[model samples]
Target: MKTIGRRMRFYRTIGAKLKGGEMAAILNISQGSYSDLEHDHAKPSSDTLIRYCTETDINIFWLLTGEGKMARPIGEVEKEKEENSEISIIWQNGMVVGNHQVDNDHKYLISLINTIQAAVNCGLGKEVILNYIAQLLSYTEVHFKREEEIQRSIKFNSLDEHKESHKRLLDQLISLRNEVGSAEPGEHQKAILEILFNDLTEWLFRHMLDEDLKMTEYFNLEKNHRVEDNSEE
Candidate 1:
C-alpha cells in the first residue's frame, strides 16, 4: 500500500467504521481513484485529504508523519468536535435540485467547504486551507461542466448567461488562488481565506438555494411531462 493509503487503512481499521465507497463519494472522486489511493499509486487531492481528515477526526500529524496516534486525544477531540459542530452549515433535503446527479454534486461541494472549516477550526494550519482551496477550485470547474451538460439537456433558457456566470465565478477563484499562491504563508492567508470563504458561501450555498432550485423546478417540470406521456403509452 502507498504511505497515505496504508495510513488510511490503519486509520480505518483502528478507529473509524465507514463503508468502502463512502470516502470516494464524499470526495466526489472515482472508486478507482480511491482504490489506487489505498495502494499508494494515486495521490489524493487536497479536497480529499481534508475531507478524510475532517470526517474521521484523524490527526493531520498522524496522516503525514505516521508517527502518532490516528485519532486525536479524547479531551481535545471532544472539545474540537463541539467547536466544529457549533459553526457548520447544516445541509438539508430542501436544497435538492430535483436532479440526482446535480444534487449529489452540490452536496459534495458543500461538504468540501465544511471539511476545510473543520480543519481550520481544529487548527490544522494555513497550508492545509490553501491546498484545499486550490483543490476545491479545480473540482468546481469539473462540476461546472457537468452543470452545463444538464443545462443543455434541459435546454435551460439562460444557458448562455449561466455559462458566463460560471466563467466569471471561476475567474474570480482563479484570481484569488493566484493572489494567495504568490503571497508568503503566514497570518495574511487567513484574510485570503475569509474572502474566498465568503465568496464560496455565496456562490455554492446561496446559489444552490436561489438559482439551482429554480433550475430544479424547470427540470422537474420537463421530467413530469415525460413521465405523464410514458404513462399514457
Candidate 2:
C-alpha cells in the first residue's frame, strides 16, 4: 500500500499476525496513537518508523516509500551480514548528532553490538555472549550520562524526554540480558540472537537517529551564535 496507514494495518493484521495492542507495544506507543497511525490520522515519527521496520524485519525503504520488497529474505540478510562482518547495523550520516564525543560513543556502541552478533554467529558459548551484552549495557550507561551532561550544558529543551528514552532502552537491555542468560543454549539460540538484532540494536538505532539527532539543530544554532560572539570581540 502507498499510504503508511494502510501498510501499517496490513502489516499488523496480516504480515506480522499481531493485534493492535501487541504491535503498539512493539513500537512503544500507545493504543490510541497506533490507531491514529493505522487510520492515517497521524504521521509517524522517525522513531516509530524505525521500530516497525527493525522489530518486524520489514524493509524500511518499503515501509516509507513502498518501493522495495516488504521484507528482506532471510538468505539476503545472512549474506549481507557476512559481506559486512565488521558492522551488523549500518551507520548512516543521518545518525550523527553533531557532537564529537557523543557521536564517538554511538560508534563504539554499534561496534559492541556487532561484536555480540559475531559471537553468536561463531557459536560462542553463552557466557561469552553474556559478557559482551554486559559490556554493551555498561558502556550504554556511560554514554547516556555523557549525553545528558552535554545536553545539560546546552540546556537542551528536550533533555527530560531524552533521559526517559534512555531509561527505557536500558530496561529493555536488562530484560534481554536476563532472557538470554536463562535460555537453553541449543534450543533458544536463534530466539536470543533475533532479539539482540531486532529489539536491542534497533532500539539504540532509533534513539540515535530520532532522539539524539534533535541535538544537531540546537547544537548548530548554539555554535553559530558563539561564532558570532567571537567575531564581535
lDDT of 1 by residue, 121-170 (tens): 66666677778877788789888899999989988998898888788778
Query: Which lDDT tens digits does candidate 2 get at residues 1-233?
Result: 11222223333323224455765775566888677445642444443444454434445554445576765454565566556544466555545678899999988997888788888878788899899999999999999999999999999999999999999989989998998888886767667765565556556755675478779988899889999999999
Error of 1 at 159 (Å): 0.3
Candidate 2 segments whose C-alpha is farther than 4 A from its true place = 1-41, 45-87
Full-model lDDT for every candidate? 0.62, 0.69
The lDDT of model 1 is: 0.62
Residue 45, model 1: lDDT of 39
TM-scores for candidates 1 onward, in order: 0.57, 0.68
Candidate 2: the clashing residue pairs are none
Error of 2 at 86 (Å): 8.9
Q: How many clashing residue pairs appear in each of the predictions shown?
A: 2, 0
In model 2, what lDDT does residue 113 have?
Answer: 81
